[model samples]
Target chain A: MALPHAIMTALLEDDMSGYELAKAFDVSVGLFWRSSHQQIYQELHKLADRGWLQCATVAQAGKPDKILYTLTEEGRDAMAEWVLGESRVQEGKDDLYVKLYNLSEDNANHLTAEISRRREHMMQRLYLYEKIRRRHYANPVSLPVRRKGVFLALLAGIRQGEQFLAWCDEALAMLGTIDEPVE
Target chain B: MALPHAIMTALLEDDMSGYELAKAFDVSVGLFWRSSHQQIYQELHKLADRGWLQCATVAQAGKPDKILYTLTEEGRDAMAEWVLGESRVQEGKDDLYVKLYNLSEDNANHLTAEISRRREHMMQRLYLYEKIRRRHYANPVSLPVRRKGVFLALLAGIRQGEQFLAWCDEALAMLGTIDEPVE
Candidate 1:
């Protein structure tokens, strides 16, 4: 349900073909809300049917025609309403944490590898977020008013990644000290 | 589903009736993996069917018999296998951050209230986590080897909540200075 709203927000930025939207999603909206290409395509049809989006076919000189989607007035209004409405706090369902909670000496070696893998993953995300911050928000005070909120959301992601990395370090240190049982 | 796995973890800690499990979930397992009472009951039945759990009925004075669930050998094996396997990193889907990304002067006032509400909620959780830490992990170094992993997971939750609260503070500070358009 919220996918349509996320799509509307992306379309508000620029009208694009489904291919462009999927690529853009991987970088931006998808950072917060993940959806598969198939799901995105399906939602596009539903949104077009509901009149929230209008699609236009553009024929290329050497390629097949592509459909570009843009938001309608209703879609814009709906987005505005959603912004002003109450937000739901999403429940956390981190499988890594669950694994940690159930970890035993028998599986300590396996978990140590997983912790390292997760730390590397968090490091990559942190690097990406920092890159975004440097590129878009080097001078936060000079940013346009419209971009300030976007910057805030990015900051949240950056902070989350940093905190998680710190926790991973602590976990690795603790795991290193615990003696693995001798076979 | 992960629900069954989470259920198994809770049951591993202590065998309890369906009602007791539900209440325990709200306080403990629910922190990491959320599920409704109905969903818990449904999964319980499925787990029993899968031979991962066994139920025993015990009659109580002035009350109907209650069925208590305990993990079987197969369930233990499943949990151990799951722990050793790769953990899927859950995608973050925070509605507040989405709204923040799309916020405009028109909806700024509404988002301000939401940020405050979320900060208060985070504060409550922080307090509860602190209480648990004091009661159970005041001396973490002295904790049993088996409990070290659980302590680490709780530490993760505490750190995440703290970081989220800090982000909420930053958001409120930024929103306060933005000039709202005069209606």
Candidate 2:
């Protein structure tokens, strides 16, 4: 259900081959959602089989036929239904947080290490967002509303990254004096 | 691994029955981490079998024997190793962002609904944080460092929740006008 929704939504803009869809997802959808190339190809076939997507095969020089997918009217209805249907937030199931909880209860020293690792990880994400923003600026999409929303989302990600990094620093600093007698 | 870490960390504070561990997770650890009771029990058994945790059975009236779990030195060692290990940020993992991305691309109307759902969810989380904060103020823990850190985390959660809810309102307003072009 998730895969088809993504596929249909992508097709609404324009028809794209499986490879092309995967690449776009990497650049655009990849920011918010991710599906492997293998998974995308598999879903393409499924959508085509279900009549929600129509495929046009174009032969490339010395290469396999590339099937491009487009959304049908039925697919449009499906997307509309999905949007209006009973929506629910999938609870965040974070393993790292769970581990942190354990560390917090047991060992302060262990938590310090985890905080260090998590801070570094957040820094990496901040970097990735910068790259994505630069790419978006270079090749502007006509949908400015969508682009603006994405930029805001990117800001949120950066904010969150910084928060985690800052939290790590604070946690580490506190650790130094954690066992020492309070001043 | 995450589950085991959570269980061990809980034990680090003091040996706790599975039920108490779950409640502690919900009240305190839950500010940043989350886990289900079933998962906690399952991980406890696994950790004990692996010699990473020591368990003591406590008699209870009108209830099954409650097993109290405590982390072993080896478990602490493992937790230390994990905490100090390199942090890897798993990218493209957020479902809500992905959904928003697709919504922006497909239709503004759909994005509105998603934002609405997020606003409500954040408000609910805000309430939960408030309840926890009040309880923490009433009863205290041994480690002042941990107590302060937990409060800081709760504050962060509250701020983030407020920001998200506010963002949703702004987004909805923008969507409302964007869809209706100037006459």
Candidate 3:
């Protein structure tokens, strides 16, 4: 359900071939709304069937026909109406927390190592988010209305990424207090 | 798969009837790892079938027999091995982000109001998380090994709750800059 809306939001940028949209999703939209390429293609067909998207096939002289999708008026109305609706707080089902709940002195090292691995992943993502911020959001407060929405979404990612990384460091420190020296 | 592990983690505190486990999950463990009561009951059956849990039926006079589940030695082994493994960062699929991406002056109020509602919900959760921190973690650094894990998990909730609230405020501020006053 969210995936269809996610695809529609991406189409707000411009009409895109399914392949181009998938690429765009991976590079940007996927950062906020994770969707597999296959899911995107499948949703594209469904959206077109529902008349949320208008699809066209363009023949080429020397290449295979290109399929493109554009948001229909109905799609824009759907997206607009959706904006007014309540959004569920997508609670993260972090297995790490469940793993931590089972922790004892005997297995502390394993969870600690896992936290370190997670920290690296968080660090790399924080770096990517910041890069996007610097490149696109110099004056986010001044961007046009729709662009401001994009900036706000990116800001959500940056703030959460920073906090998540900080929590990793804090978790390691707390674990250190009770960690036994390896023999 | 995670629900099974999540159930095992809950059982670490004590063996419980499925009813008690479901209640416990709703109040505490569900905060970290969310699952429906139906899903929890289903996973309990699956785990018992896999020999990770032992289900015993104890008869009560003039009442239905109570079915209790205890983590087996194999369950402990599974939990231990699972702790060493990697955990995926459960990136929240926040539809608000997609809604934001479609922002325009016409629909600005709709999204702005949606954010306000989200902020209130987030504030209430943050307050609850803080309440738990105060009640259990008087001296987090000195807690026993296993208890330290519990504190850390709660700290994750507290930390993320605070950050999400901050982001909501920042988002509103950014939106405020361009919002047209309704006549």
User: In terms of lDDT, which candidate is strongest?
Assistant: 1
lDDT (tens digit, per residue) of candidate 1 on B73-125: 99999999988877777888877777777877887888899999989998998
Model 3 spans with C-alpha error above 4 angstroms: A59-65, A180-183, B59-65, B180-183
- Candidate 2, residues B1-183, lDDT tens digits: the string is 355665666677787988989988766654454667898888888888899988888999998888888778998888767654544454535555545544443456666777777787778888988887777744434445556555555655666676667667766765665553334
Model 2: residues with Cα > 4 Å off, grouped in runs: A1-3, A62-65, A93-183, B55-57, B62-65, B92-95, B102-114, B130-156, B178-183
Interface RMSD of each: 1.2, 4.1, 1.4
Q: What TM-score does each of the candidates earn?
A: 0.97, 0.73, 0.92
Superposed on the true interface residues, model 3 gives a C-alpha RMSD in angstroms of 1.4
Instruction: Judging by lDDT, tell me the better candidate of 2 and 3.
Output: 3
What is model 1's DockQ versus the real complex?
A: 0.75
List candidate 1 segments past 4 Å from native: none
Models sorted by lDDT, best on top:
1, 3, 2
Better of 2 and 3 by TM-score: 3
Which stretch of 10 consecutive residues in model 3 chain A shows the poorest summed lDDT? A174-183
Best by TM-score: 1
lDDT (Cα, tens digit) per residue for candidate 2, span A123-160: 87778877877777444334476566565566567666
